[model samples]
Target: MDRKGFSRRQFLQMMASSTAAAIAASAMPLTTLAQDSMSYNEAPMLADLVASGNLPPVQERIPANPRVVTPPEEIGQYGGTLRRAFKGISDRWGPTKLNEEMAIEWDIPDPDTVNVVANYISEWVQNDDATEFTFTLREGLKWSDGHPFTTVDVQFWYDWYYMGDLADRPTPITIAGEPMELEVVDELSWTVRFPAPNPLLPLAIAKLTLGSWAGPTMAAPAHYLSQYIPDLTTDQSLIDAAMEENGVDTWQQLFGDGGTPQGQIAGWWFNPDLPVINAWKSVNHPSNDPWLAERNPYYHAVDPEGNQLPYIDGMTHAWFDDNAVFDLWIAQGEIDAHIRHVASANFTFYKENEAAGDYTVLLWRAAETQAFYPNISHKDPVLREIFNDARFREALSISINRQELNDLVYEGLFEPRQASPVSGSPNYDPEFETRWTEYDPDRANALLDEMGLELVDGVRMRPDGEPLSFTILFQSALAQRGDEVNLVESYWEALGLQVNQELVERTLYQERTDNGDVDVGVWSADRNSVVMADVSRYTAEQADGPWAPLYGAWWANSPRAQEEPPADHPIREIWRLWEATLVEPDEATRNALFKEMLDIHKEHPYMIGTVGEGPVPFIKKNNVGNILGGNIWDDTLRSPGGVASVTWFFRS
Candidate 1:
């Protein structure tokens, strides 16, 4: 049984004992004794009644806020066609990038281009409290097959695609940590009851509406998938037959299975003839040339100008493997837009080409970039002991002169920052900003002494008689940073710290990190939205497999914390506070609780933050306003930081 049920049983047992003691204390006549004896036997039964339903409730403070609604004025309307380039993604229309691109085109409502994507649902908030939330379907929305969009479409999406309980088809039931929950309130309206009252719900919803946490997730036309869902349930071999036809082992593998491959058939766009529910529907594709997208006539949203959206007629996406070749493409105006910049290191090419009057280069400072973190899960106890020393960590941070590295290595284009997961936003604490570790070998040596690390025979060893050497598994494709790695090696060597850098292929590097096999490594954490608490979900320990991105020295209650948490400590407290927030009716209390959560996160330095960079898109001269630029956030959808594709226009 659950916690409540067990508590009730214990309370009943205590009451039974108290009643029996009272009956024994009351002296009675001999005749009354017989009646008293009989009553005594039944007294135990009375306690059973209390255990059944008489127990007092577990009280909690509920949140005061209700749901929220977004005003119509936040919606934007205009027209423009944007041309983008395709990255080396496995499948262009897979649930990953395609959904994001599609959502950008028409799915979300108001968008903050730098950080996140907004969905169609609009919410209203008064101060920190949500008053009401209203979801209006894209009025004229329709399926690619020309079926009218309605509440049924939303219901079908949750029932089939998400929940998948109506049909017996095997599904990807779990992701990150929790099983996705789906409940429909009614047609044209559905409410997500946060497990607790969350003060940041509005901000979270705003991010979601932008499609940061969620992608377009096109409301699947149940008319099409329904036929297949039932067939798979009715015939046991139907799933097998489909897998064989697609030459894949499982449906999940069709989406790359956490590894990149040359090709995969994962979406409707994979078929040149199939119709897709994207703002800019695909019209043509050629291997050596740009792909095209025509405006969908049945598009859902009406522009502010009272016209159908998708201001531009269509788009062309050119794919290039070489950075220099892409620069040339932009300079020569051969490609419509280079949506991603690959040659930031070759700023000379950008500066010289732009100065010579080929095209303008919009350089963006990517928010989430490089930082080193110790893999606490390394199997060696000796290495673990060395890493456990905070002094050692502080020493390492100081050893690497980030300012010098940015200047010498990146040619003064990057920013220096303390390693933290939430560095770019208002959540970043200025008080928490510690000074950059000075490039003093003496200071590094002093900190090493404090940690009991000593140099013996040209190797640093712990005072506990443990060796102080570790290997860093780095990505081998960093051919551009061969000099930087050499410089890092030299710095560590000065302190008699043996740092080994093992370069592995990109795939291998990603696999090791996923599998928790690396010792020390550098990685990037993109900015994400905490409105739904989705980004922070996997940060804590899961009931099952794999650690979250926030798993590191900074998580206070983590197994690696200096002061291990009690059984019901910070995390459990957060859960309880979160639960209370759900039922709370007071706005001030809810906001206070949210601030508390933010405070806790700030205190815990989960991911050593680096620089705030932007995802800069290189647009062609003809597509001047086509580029999207903003500080690179941990969560790409929530903090995309620029205009949603709705405002783009093709300059004549």
Candidate 2:
């Protein structure tokens, strides 16, 4: 299965020698003076140690010129438990990842700008062609466990783990449709080279910086992870030893499983066995109820006055199964601050309960969560064929009067637009919002009939004479949008298409989408927030198969599954345009490519869209400060991007 010329055994023997050389090449010193500029103060829990001259001063524990954070009211007291909750275990890692890994991302003021800012890395130098990039890591930076994190760690993650070890997992290769090369420049620097120019390289690094995941900028410590890697350890017996200790299946499972005690992939999963650089680390990992974590003493960020960031000492997260009772919970006055998952529909109820609960609801225009977007790539074989037809999607798009839909569901507050880039994006085109959007049932009926979906006794019939009707699969988390879904179903049904709706658990819904099992899929997007990271979704060839499983499967592996598009496929140009868009060196040229792709979406209504921009609610305790007050709520600007909850403090 591994085409990389090394089986588990060969790679291990090679690592036995390579790891020997890399061991000393990897040990970075933690007592460096880069942290000398900051003042020091320990948390109240550890205040006695500082008073008694028992522990190292806070200056030595924090980064030099620690990434400064200006809270709403000066700096904050360093102790209070931030309480939060979510519905699922997979969502547990989210709070841990917030504002923790800030590195390598371009600071786009809006989606339009091309200017990039250096954050985690000290410096970055790109070649004229944009194919090669040289980077310098922050000097004297140490992991939470006092491990010296160096360029060698990055090299190990890129060359060995991402490119080599993960035989089945997907990477940039799946997106760019090309391979990449990584080289360690020095103890504190590295280089990444693509076969072709990749202007999106910074975007990739930027995403990695914002997210708490394994990335080139945030590599696993080679010295710490070597014991688990079979190649690095040079002993298969160690694998069994680890399996017996951790109760996992294999070395790969143990090492790649970053959430468990074995793998320390990110700053969020900061365990004693694992090291981190974030402001906080989990105190009780893999926890279901009241999941807890504590502040990282050696945090790389600080308040304006040099106090280490994360004004709060720790956090505790609860879990819930149903969102139907979210408003009930908010009304109960038990929630501290909630803004992530609570929908806008509950704002009225939330406002009625706000005074008693001691919370305030902050409403920001939401671009991603407002609309009903139909995935044209429905999974059922019969429905897939119909949904894939551009005419079918166009008819669905034109039949829905978004204004009426918005008026009915959101009280006419949301913008009646399409699933394209919003105002700020360099790619935003007005035509995308208007094309084929008028309410025209006659035209829709004509299009269906032209596509040979004839009207049989009032309902549209398939080519094989079966009823051309399918249930739109929806996630229960979006129960608030149930009315919107039902409304859209009526419009389609009015066009002699018997449309139905099915509500399922979020987990089950996602699983079905991933497997391409559902009929019509209901979803929405804040297109600007996701444009760079998930551009493939806009095109036919996708690494993530949920949107278009058949095309995704073909793109993921041309050898397996059903089919591939001919050279002249409607979306093949989108695929080619994406390649050029990411690779184009000039900013204007890249933007033009983005515009062209948006135009293609307009020209071919691949995904049906209804209401677009709408208000998404952000409710938090009145005392919570540093809420990043502003009008802008794009992906990177609002809670979507500004989850630096670490910088927040209680006003009291």
Candidate 3:
């Protein structure tokens, strides 16, 4: 990959950032610019074009690519609205945090999540290759006060949210560096450019910039959040020191001191009191009661005949505990459709209410992949050595029966999974499927013996005289379900491994998870796609702050080596190949890489994964056509804020 020597086509078509436009313009042929692919030489050519007077060349450009799929007949319509309700607003809105998860589920549009505002918003980089993207803003898109929504708004989002911290921009903000351009092609149009090639970028752009780890839940209105940037970004060392002096040791205290009552709502809503949510604005709500929404004239999308959307009237959300959502839906039938199903620790109620048809409990499997993490940071040298041992890992792999786990933990509601990431996703490699060891006590015992782990005084001890006892701390809330910890504890006890279980509250659980305090813990890394770049970012060895590097420190220190240098491990080589696929423009090459990654991940047990499931939504009969298969409900679509149940009336 002599990135410098390649011609434009070779550079653009090559595996990675070889065809970068900026690099090309500096040293390549001007005539070869835009040579169909973005190979190394083409980048320089394109850069030359930009550097020359021809930069930002004037033209009335239209998409030469194939048209996007039209919204389904059931989707494109006017008059109807969807009123949804939620338990509460989500937390972080940044990338690699809880807020990101919420946004993925709600704000962004991907292959999953059927209903998404991003889909309606014309994007700058609209296609797969991301060779080009453009956005034409809604004709009269405006804030509640009638200020126009323009390129500035998008630019603000990029500048404040996506510019810094690789962790800050999960999906979009692809160029790994600061934002470059926010060109206003026209009043209603704009062009944003990345420094490098990123085909996976359009989906990233649609997602919230900060805390993307948590999944898509909400988005910050750039209009309002920008107001605080100057103050927040300013040097307040004195204030921070004072806070520390005052015993506010946590970063949250400094970052989240007194501001305003609506401070928390800034990430999801522009002005909570004003109640402007996307295509509609809230009009009325009972004192200390649920809120309502009405159509907004400022909404940009229009029907072919020129009528605005949201044909149906407004809707309401009864803010309550998780169970109340289900109860209200069944009793008063307030839930036209559970746009987002809220679950709590209480499974007993869910089980009882489900059989009675209490609001149609759509017990779809969770879209998250849960796995048991074996921290290589275990202090006991002997135990650590065994964990690092391939035979032990293989033994653990075979010892645990996934079928029994599926039957036990999920109550037979989900399928068994073996892949580390999404089991059935397009990126999942079938060849990498690690089979669960049959429930053979003999084989389990034999593998342990083969590794010289022996039972002494009812506790498994390694050959070096180190006890096999280790604590597995799990979230107490989830522990209560199906007696989860007990099941695991019993299973490991049968394997002659002393498993000490500790169930802690959510806060403590989070702290331990962050500190990597527990030897083994159960968690789910539910991401959009398991690209090496995405995982590498998460597993990087030395991460600072709330986010941990995507890969745990244990896996990178392997002694195994196919290359001359042990550091040049075969696995890392495989990973690099896998990562190259993320930016590949060709679909066939990308698919091949995806397959390879999956196969390799399965073979190397980077992290053992268990299952895959859908985030289910329960809808009422009146809202029959409202639900889309992959739509993860966002707070904006919930009652009192967004289009509410009335958005359903827009059915084509």
Candidate 4:
């Protein structure tokens, strides 16, 4: 496959020239430029607050140069709550994806291209070698509580939280295993200097899991968090009182309590007091039956007509413990707009009831429905040796009938392919997508026989004269995962292998994977579109993915790393290639380095990919305006956030 899309270097260069102009003419307003000439508008709810002297005027609240969002359909009215549904407290990503605000964000102008644009920050400039980045905050920008957001907040987050006691959280940008140095340029600007060139820093900041408000390098409200920190606070008695109230012995534990900065900031849905820069601020905790978030009066962005966003007055998230109940609610027109947790199996029921429910069902593309990870680094030495063999992994991949799984599980709506990049991605390869994805049980049996595994009484026996058996560990949160694994269990059992499926809670599932106790890990292959931004699946860089959790811990230099790969391990070469790709400034050279790393995965089927590029149903009420359909549903783009949910509203 020929590489066709712009690399990070090319994209940054274009941003410096033509793209910069387009941004300025559209969303990226210059902070230095005054907006005094234009008359600003506000929602009636906020206008009443201003009239009552509880809030500042619309012009005073918004930044001097507010980001402009052009509505997809038309200018939206502002008086209704955007109703949605969530599973439980553990489902933080559900709301985080919809409301996350970052310093920078990915701008997908079209399906094939992704460009980085300033979001919370007004603008940014990268040095020639990409060693340093200077970010200038939007002038007059304020947090949800109306506190001025400046370089001080960034400094507090970096120095006090990140580099200080909360060092367990991974640093967002690092080069040569060293953290970047932050330099305070001014009240509104700061610079981050790395020891070596870090070309992927921009994209790293735009990734949902890495750089959003709830991510590791989070932007802390210094004024509010200072009260909890003993070093920052003048009163020792207050710290003692807080610690005692929270029933913790140390100040660190108290500072991380439910109501404090760390706990609430990371889990914003649970605490309404946490200051945020997102369009909406939580007014009620998630524990409430229907959690609510009111519009942030001081939100930085505005519509093209100078009306402050979000066009909707507020948002309400109803809780449901079961997927069936959630689907039934959607069928009853109870949800205004939602993307996550809508089951593909309920597509027919949703479509049949759409007209009666007065809602529209829009299908977006999912990167992949499910990908199986055989634990090559399993604790059991015998199973580990067998799993590490390339032929065994290949046999496992070819044994499953992907077409049958797609038909029975997804109603033949998804594409049956091996785990690879999205079809139109620059790194995508046709051969990689179709390799070893055939339903050939005879070939699988032959491969098993070649491995000296004899079938006795319809059960395969291990080399150690024991029954060859393994368990598939998956989370119970997603119903589709259970269905996928059940079919896989049947297929493997048919091949005379003992297979067991254990569905655990999300927390226990993570605990098991991190401890390297799971025989197999089941998860959806998200972040497939932008492989470079997050290479955890391909390379054992982090435990975010299921493959080689212990190896990833060692790669991350975490204290919890129980096992490390030998010096000559192939993953070491992958790490080297990725590190080189980070510093390589030339677009072509950087891409080539990525291709080399991907080639390693192609040769070794580390993560067995099943069907992908399937439709994800997004339900929207008829009254909801400015909601765009047909977008890619990947964690990298952050789903509805990539589509800009701030501009959505109810048409009165």
**Number of the top-ranking candidate, with lDDT as the measure:** 4
Which regions of candidate 3 fall more than 4 Å away from where they truly are? Answer: 1-120, 123-132, 164-184, 206-223, 231-265, 269-358, 361-370, 377-386, 408-411, 420-424, 462-464, 476-481, 525-575, 611-625, 628-646, 649-652
TM-score of each candidate? 0.65, 0.85, 0.62, 0.91
> On residues 236-287, what C-alpha lDDT tens digit does candidate 3 reach at each position?
5644564465466533332232211122223223223332334445444222
lDDT accuracy of residue 594 in candidate 2: 77
* 459 Cα displacement, candidate 4 (Å): 1.4
Model 1 per-residue lDDT tens digits across residues 1-652? 1111113233224323322222122111111011112111111222343357542111100001101112223332234444455533321421223223222221122222222223332221232333233344433345444565455665665564444533211111122223334445554454433323333333333333221112333244455444345433565465456568669766434322322111132244443333345545656543435665665544443333333344455666666554556667656555544434434555555545553444555433343445555654445557655654556666776677767777776665555665432333333344443433356678888889877777898788856676677776666434445556666677778888888888766556656665556667655444322222333432333201112222422332232222223454344455545445444557567546655664543454333433423223344453355443322223333323223453344544
Model 4 ranges with Cα > 4 A deviation: 1-33, 109-113, 168-172, 208-212, 215-218, 237-249, 253-262, 541-544, 558-562
**Deviation of model 2 at 368, angstroms:** 2.4
Find the 10 residues in a row with the least total lDDT in model 4: 18-27
Q: Which residue runs does candidate 2 get wrong by more than 4 Å?
A: 1-38, 46-55, 92-102, 106-116, 167-178, 209-218, 234-238, 241-248, 255-272, 369-381, 540-546, 556-563, 631-638
lDDT of 2 at 242: 62
lDDT of 3: 0.42
Ranking by lDDT: 4, 2, 1, 3
TM-score between candidate 1 and the true structure? 0.65
